[model samples]
Target chain A: MRRALKVIVLGVWLLITLFPLYWIIVTSLKPKAEIFTLPIKYWPGNVTFEHYADLFSFADFGAYLLNSLLVSLVAAAGVTVIGVLGGYTLARFSFPGRGALMLAFLVTQMLPLFIALGPLYLLMSDLDLLNRLAGLMLVYVAMLVPFSTIIMRGFYERVPVALEEAAQVDGASRIVAMVRVVIPVMLPGIAATFIFAFVQCWNELFLAITFIDSEDAKTIPVAMNSFITQYDIDWGSMAAATVVSVLPTLVLFAAIRRYIVEGLTAGAVKG
Target chain B: MRPAFTLRKARFIALCLLPGVVFVVLFTYYPMIRGMVIAFQRYNLFDITSTPFVGLENFRAVLAEDRFWTALRNTGTWVAVSLFFQFFLGFGLALLLRRHFRGRGLYQAWVFFPWAMSGFLIGLLWRWMFNGQFGVINDLLLRTGIIDQRIGFLATPGWAMTSVIVANVWYGVTFFAIMIMAALQSVPKELYEAADVDGASKLRQFWHVTLPHIRPTLALIVLLRIIWILNFPDLIYSMTGGGPAGSTDIITTFLIQQVIGGDYGRGGAVGLLILGLLLAFSVFYMNATRFEKAR
Candidate 1:
């Protein structure tokens, strides 16, 4: 009896968790006439690809997708590379001001980026960077570098220092030792850090909406927000766009699910 | 080591670290300092050429608005209520998922999926779900014979905050479950076995063994979540835009409106106040936790 009750509870929670995602997917595929039926159709009677087609043809969603992809990818790569170098420095050496730098990074993680919005906007406009993709990419890189560097530092600390020492003993310089020996072993960590940063940049909406007003420079989240604010929200197209927007993050997260708990808790748990 | 070799190593370290430091300082710290300065100036977007020092005029203007106090009260309710539900429900979830079961890995991934979604998108999803005319929620309620007629969840002031809190609870439970589960796993198996040998009931064992073991983590995560919930305005922004007479407006959303409305000085003042609020809470939290540890 206890076992049965446990199973039933789990099953009910599972349904509650997945029902919204399932509903959105179903809504996206349903015919327009069938969506707002009196007694909401639990299943779409006639599935249609019309909404997905409309996203491409009428909505100009392709540009937003490309923009999101470019910014997320470039920023993820930039943050990961910088994180590796910075992580390595913090892990391997104890230099002047290192402690203060590390504390500053931790403090930055706790700060709400909304606090910087007003001045950031003014500064970006002064630099002629508003409504530009490159500008958005720079902000993302800065925002992510601190957390990614901390995760990377945790990863670097796990690898024994003796391996690099052995390489240096074999007539390899410190730089070469890092490039050839340490980096090869840290590939998985690097990938996890990159995916974490990528998802953050991909899902960012506030800064994107603040800086990029031009339709051409808008990212996926910005496009979706604009769609929501329209006079008559096309529910079908909105659902379709949401599905497309969420696919990349969901896939990337699944790939790195194992590292997520560790990566997220490393700073807080240790402190 | 030789002086030349030490010098070369120091240069290499600096080379590795410079880019990260420069980017952080230029983007994060610089804007924050400038934002603080802007709070004291008459920094209007309409007349940016002459932004003179105003000596707390911006602060006075922001404080004079009744909307600011409403937002502050709503922020307290939003954070406290959301945190209460999220912690208990998530703790239950963590307990339920602790025991081994078939397909557990897959189940965990599926349940934790909401944490991977954007807050703005989650807001949009809940907004549509709560729609009175064609919403799934009303449909479910009617079919279940719970309500006689449809009710607008977002269009009404009273229901809007409740609706958003429900969505937040749905989204945030996964995070607590994940973090708490990790903390639970760190408790050694031997400790549980010893508790069982001592004739402890499940409830007693939980109180004595599990609670004590994870208290620090629980305290820290709760504090972190409090700060995060207060700062998070994306869901409220996209869901109701603090609608139905600004009933659901939180401090962060209020600040966003100030910025979007072209009053950077007021926005900057709001931003500084948020910073001050968070810093004050953090200091209080740290001291309380330290006192607990000492006891």
Candidate 2:
């Protein structure tokens, strides 16, 4: 009887959760007439790629996808480099400003990014970086790096001091020890941090929309929003836009799912 | 502090930590320091430096505005409502997932799907779904005999704020679920087994054992979630753009339109207000939690 209640409750939650997802998929496949029907249709009446086609022809959907891909990948790679190295240092070494710096990172990590939004915009404007992909990258890096570093710090903290000392005990250079010994154990953690950074950059909205206005640099979400701003939205097309926007997020989440799982575990439980 | 022997080790570590430190200092710390300074001046859009320092002018202006109170009320309401649903639903779902169930993996992946969906995209999706004339929600309700007429979910005052909260809850639930699930999983299986052997039912076990075990994690997750959601401008920005009557306007959204829309001084004041609330809440929560434990 106890087990039965668990099963029932679990089943109902699944229905509530997946129903919107199913709706998204169905709306993507449905014709316009069936999308906003008299009764809300659970199943698509007739499947069509017409909306997807419309998105491609009218908007820069491909460019947005490419931009999102490039940014997510590059930003993840950059953050991992900083996170792993900085995190390793914070974990292993006893330095003067170490505690203060860690506290600083924590402060930056949790503050609302919008608090800096106004001033950062003005600064970016001064530097002639507004509407540039590079500017967006800078903001993303600033926002995401602290998190990645924090994540890396946790992973590094879990490693013992003896290992690195032993590596140096064998007359290995500091850099060499990092590359050869320390990193091998920390690779899974590093990979997890990378996945976390990658997904965040991919899905970031507020600053991206604020900063990147030009078609040349638009990410997937902004371009997707263009479809939504229309008076008579082609529901099928908007659905396609959602599909396109979600593709990289899905792929990154799937490919790095194991690492992603680990990162989230760290962030929630141990963090 | 063995200086001579570990000097090189110290320098190497400092070098490693420097690059990241410089960035945080420049971007996060610098902006905060600058925001405090900006709060003093009547920071005009067309000429920033040219604008004279009007001591406490911005603060006074912000306080005097009726909209500031509305924003405070809206933001406070948003945070409370969002946190309430997010924690409860998330914890509930995590509890459900703890059971031995078929397709749990698939269920989790699907459940986590919204978290991956862009905040901007979710905003747009909800906006479309809630559209009055052709929206799926209104159509569904009328067809189901729930309401006689199409309700303007976004346009009306009472409904607008509630609508934004509902959409926020939808996106927020995934976040809390993932956090709570990780915490729940880390509870040693042996503990549960021992509890079962001792004849403690699930409810008792959850209250006595599980709650205390995961308390710290629960606190941290809630703290982090509140900070993040409170500052988030994009989700609200894209959803209703602070809505039909400014009823749904929050601190972040208010700051954005005011500051980013070129009301630098007033917006900066609003930003400071938000910063104060977050700081106050965090300190208060930590104190209360610690005080409760001490008692």
Model 1 regions lying over 4 Å from their true place: A266-271, B1-5
Measured against the true two-chain complex, the DockQ scores of the candidates, in the order shown, are 0.58, 0.47
lDDT of 2 by residue, B45-103 (tens): 76765867788889898889888788888988998998899889988888777765678
Residues A46-84 of candidate 1 have per-residue lDDT tens digits of: 999999999999988999999999999999999999999
Candidate 2 segments whose C-alpha is farther than 4 A from its true place: A36-40, A160-166, A225-234, A259-271, B1-5, B47-49, B100-102, B186-199
Residue A228 in candidate 1 has what lDDT?
A: 77
- Residue-level lDDT of model 1, residues B1-295, one tens digit each, is 2124377778988898888888889888999888889899999988889999999999999999999999999999999999999999889889889988999899998997886788898888888899889889999999999998999999998899999999999998888888999999999999999999999999999999999889998999998888888878999988898987999999999999998888989988999998899999989999998888778
